[model samples]
Target chain A: MKFLHTSDWHLGRQFHNVSLLDDQKVVLNQITAYLQDNKVDAVVIAGDIYDRSVPPTAAIELMNQFVETVCGELGVPIILIPGNHDGAERLGFASKQMKGAGLHILSNFADMVTPVIISSDIGPVAFYGMPYNDPELVRHHFKQSVSSHDDAHKLLCDEIKTHFNAEHKNVLISHCFVDGAIESESERPLSIGGSDRVSHEHFVDFDYVALGHLHQPQKKGEEYIRYSGSLMKYSFSEQHQKKGMTLVEFDEQGFRSATHIDLVAPHQMRIIEGELDTIIEQGKTDPNNEDYLLVRLMDKHAILNPMDKLRAVYPNVLHLEKPGMLIGMEQEMASAKLARSETDMFRDFFLEAQNSELSEEQDKAISDIIKQLSQQ
Target chain B: MKFLHTSDWHLGRQFHNVSLLDDQKVVLNQITAYLQDNKVDAVVIAGDIYDRSVPPTAAIELMNQFVETVCGELGVPIILIPGNHDGAERLGFASKQMKGAGLHILSNFADMVTPVIISSDIGPVAFYGMPYNDPELVRHHFKQSVSSHDDAHKLLCDEIKTHFNAEHKNVLISHCFVDGAIESESERPLSIGGSDRVSHEHFVDFDYVALGHLHQPQKKGEEYIRYSGSLMKYSFSEQHQKKGMTLVEFDEQGFRSATHIDLVAPHQMRIIEGELDTIIEQGKTDPNNEDYLLVRLMDKHAILNPMDKLRAVYPNVLHLEKPGMLIGMEQEMASAKLARSETDMFRDFFLEAQNSELSEEQDKAISDIIKQLSQQ
Candidate 1:
């Protein structure tokens, strides 16, 4: 059985008040075409289907059309789980009824082991859909008298392993930030206020783990756990990284290595520094590269109607940043070059702040501030 | 085919912050029991299954239990449509997939004619589900130049008739306020900041129209258009109305008259007007009724902690209105009684004001105020 792994579509996302509908449509069309061409059996949308819980009508319609086209016209099965960004209950509505069309939606903890059995020539393959976990829900689910970051995840792994069969190939779908996965600039880190993290080792029992939440397509370790990354580069930090989906094949032996399908989206984010007129002239010469254009002007004086001028030459000119970014980049590079021993740096900072005397309370406050800053 | 017609469950509805879950549970349980005893083939929930678009998980669980109990356990086909208050696209998510479990959710105008053919012992009965109509949606659905409220509704009726079969007992379910149905305070009226009503005659084609939106159990004229009413009295204006669901039986000849199963929930909504102390004493005698009490205090002075006193006697006390309601009620009654002709009253009043010899500007201002008051 061949499966297409993708997640964090965020269909109705808005970047700086500009609607991503057009770009999203382009990417979605590409994905649909890819699925049809590749003859993918099942598509796994891990989570974060919509940017917000309360999506607009347009988002809903787009989702409906996509689902209809995939399941109705193309005859592909879809297994979707809800992310932290979605309303689980809303997503799970009429799920029991929708099973006939081969679209499986799992949004609750109770439905973790209820796999959609897909029959292949080898045997029956189980596709498990697990939604994003909240620590509070995890605690309540197990009814365990414990308070720790790893407690819930450990329990979830234990409970999930009970339903697994060593005889058949078990593929688990999840939306979680495992320890040590690379994060994109636009990717929201799972836990900001608390040190809540699930060890990547917990997923070792399953033959394959199709993961979401991390927006950078990368492997974790020697294990079969991987993140498919986001559909498109949502931020500048992801500009240097490759964005795409994963194709996993499974047989009687177990799970096989996945192939990363590179996404050729309309826009390729770029950062350039030059005068407005010069950049415009350069963009005009590259007429075929009209899909994406980023112009950064180096001029000290403001250019009137810069957006209008750039757009006149390139309709897809998405970003415009001043040469101030270059100054910031140079400063960052200089800081990175400077090296100081941790102990010496702290002693020098303390001596400078206290002059001749340093109180215990003041020292403790400084240490606390340093600890907070380091965490950020 | 015997089908039970019901709507406006409003599962998570709270009457002024008072949880109606208990009442809803009782009503829903009774409905399940009625279905079992009567041996109904199908159940039609016209619209407004949930009070809000994004209902809580508890509400979702309750809905799941109900669907599982009615359709999953009993094997009765339960059909649903979205009402004005519901998010149609959200409710309709993966609806086509769920058809295997005999649960149908219709949330779009495009699928209005696509009836579910239920093969009962008698024959194949076509059940059509039409969601609540928005004028804008109606215009878009028909793809024509619709100018007025009547035109929009007429187009929908016309479309429905094109698919309507006279030979079979065609049952139609809708969520719209008909012209002559009794209005209840429990209902959120069609408040588009003005009056825009669909004529009652548009629903004449169907053998039965299981209507919703208006939370009043009633029949307009002698035809088969009926409102099953809300499961519980959501407001004081509905205190006089009986709350229940309608069970209808259809045969080869046509539709048969159905019986309304009266539902008495654990709590009953009451409006009691008295002094705080007296009402508290009354509540003590009937402590069980206190939980469902809607006390309207008419004390001369403001009563501090009146709710605390009332709750001590009646735990289910929902509302505590200050003395102003009594005054307002009296003013309403007095205005109703004073039915003098506006023209005659204005002439006599004007003659008396002329005796005072006010300035022309003042007369004009007074006349304007009088005119506005008369219109009201």
Candidate 2:
């Protein structure tokens, strides 16, 4: 079976108040284009299809367009699960209805046992989806003592094992924070008061574990257990990580080859660091000026409407970071203010109010008033 | 052709701060029950499936469930249009994908001309949907002088006519406010400044005109033209009108019979009017006290915690109206203040402040003080 493994779409997410719908659309079109040419048996979406429970209408429309082109038109079956970001009930709404159309959504705990078995050369590869569920839900479902995500996931895998056939190769699709996996600024924490970390050992029993919840494309203890990563760089922290999907090809022997296919965003996410003037001067001849940028200024002095000036050159500059420069500038100003005498401070204020410096006699009278106050 | 016509679901709507989801689910269950037993050729939702453009996640789930049950499990075709309340772009998502599964969402201006032809007993019933569109859309669509809704709709119908086959028995499923239809509080005004009303003559040529946008169920200029009404009573203004769907049966010639089937709600909505004590007394013995109620208090005197007291008996009381009693009390208080002498008013104030009556000397001193102040 050749499976296109991708996850953590985070549709409807806004970056620093700017809508990512246009960026998302461009990336999704690229995904659909790959599906159009590739003879992929199925597409496995690990989880986190949406950024939130209630996505905006445009995001919903984009998802619709993607599925219509991939599943409806391209005739590829998509296996999906709901991540912590998605509303399980909302995402799983028409699972049965859309199943016949090759959109298999494994969101409910009750139906987790029933796998989406697609026939491949390696025999039927059974796809199991374990959507991100809380410990409370896990406890209620299995009547087991589940205090953490680890306990919940272990119990879930145990249940799936009783139903899963040992003869067939199984691909476990899940969305959870596994131990040893890296974290990103974009991923919402699974739990607040308790640990949501699940051990990767529990999933290693399966032939392959397709995971989500982290944005970086990396493997677990074993190379077979992998996170295909998100479609785009969701945060500045993820600027260095190349976003992509995993295309897994298998034969009769099973686990033949898994390759990382890099997906490109129309506008690259970059952190441009330099003095404000240097960056602006570079932008004058810079070919990639339109890329989404976070400028880190090394300048010690304050600038007026720095963002406006930067945007005049680099139109897509999203954020301006001063780093330690602001604190250093503030300390310098504080010391300079302390070094000046109170009379000099008064003279400065007088100068500011009258648009001129105080006269020598006026300054002397202010000093005499200060001396008298000091005596009292 | 037999068509089960319904409209104005208004999902995600809240009545007087209380969610109507439970009520909506109850009525939807009833509709699905009817569909389960009857041979419904096609289900036509005229428009307004949701109460707002971006509905709550729960509302989206409900819509998903409804479509899955109707089009997926029941194997029936549903033709729907986006009304003024729905975001056309959001609702129209996956239209092409779900078309084969029998959920036809006619939301786009470009797709409005293309009819969903379902073969019925009489012939192919060409269902033409005209979603509630503003004048701007109409003007942009046709590049014509479409200044008002009337001009817009006339042009739209003209466009549909050009593509529509004359031989087919056409059913115009629209969400426009016809000139002669009755209005209700729940129905949103289609236009802000100009008239949204389209002439009945513009739609007279169709075999049967199924309309929405008006909450009250009634026939328009002709017998064939009708509003199926909303699924439930959305407002207290519709207290008297029986909420239901229209079942239109057709023959070889044209429309044979159009019957209105009444739908029942779990908790009946009612407006109770009387004094608070009497209503409470009635509620003491009333079995249907849990029904949603809007009480009109006729008590002239001030009643302490009247709503709290009424809710003790009728737990589902949503609103309590004082009506003319508050106005009357305010007027009485104003007149009583006018009639009272200055000294009398001061004595009353003194008594209120000290929780004791003012002495004759104190009252006389106050009067003397007031006279001195007036002279000054």
lDDT of 1: 0.77
> How would you encode candidate 2's per-residue C-alpha lDDT over A183-260 as one tens digit per residue?
888888898754988899898788888999889999988888899999899998888999989998877766777899
Candidate 2 per-residue C-alpha lDDT over B1-376 given as tens digits, one digit per residue, 9 for 90 to 100: 6889899999989999989898899899998999999988999999999999878878888888899899988999999999999988877765665677888889887668889999876778899998888989889877989889899888888888888787799889899888867888888898765388889888888889999889888899988999999989988868898999999989998888899999977878899999888999999999998999999998877888988999999999999899748977998999998898787888888889999987878878999998888789
Instruction: Report the error of model 2 at residue A375, Å.
Output: 26
lDDT of 2 at B296: 94
* Candidate 2, residue B270: how far the Cα is off, in Å: 2.4
Q: Write down the lDDT that model 2 would get.
A: 0.87
> Candidate 2, which segments miss by more than 4 Å at Cα?
A192-194, A327-331, A337-376, B327-331, B341-376
Model 1 TM-score, 2 decimals = 0.82
lDDT of 1 by residue, B1-376 (tens): 6788788888888778877887788878988888777788888888989998766667877898899888888989899898877778777876776777888888877667888877876677777788776676677767787755566767877887888665566777888777766777666765464355667688777778888888888887544788888777888767778988888877776677877878877777778888877877776677466447777778755556877887787777777787665676677778875876554466567679776555678667777887899689
- Scoring model 1 with DockQ, what do you get? 0.41
Error of 2 at B179 (Å): 0.5
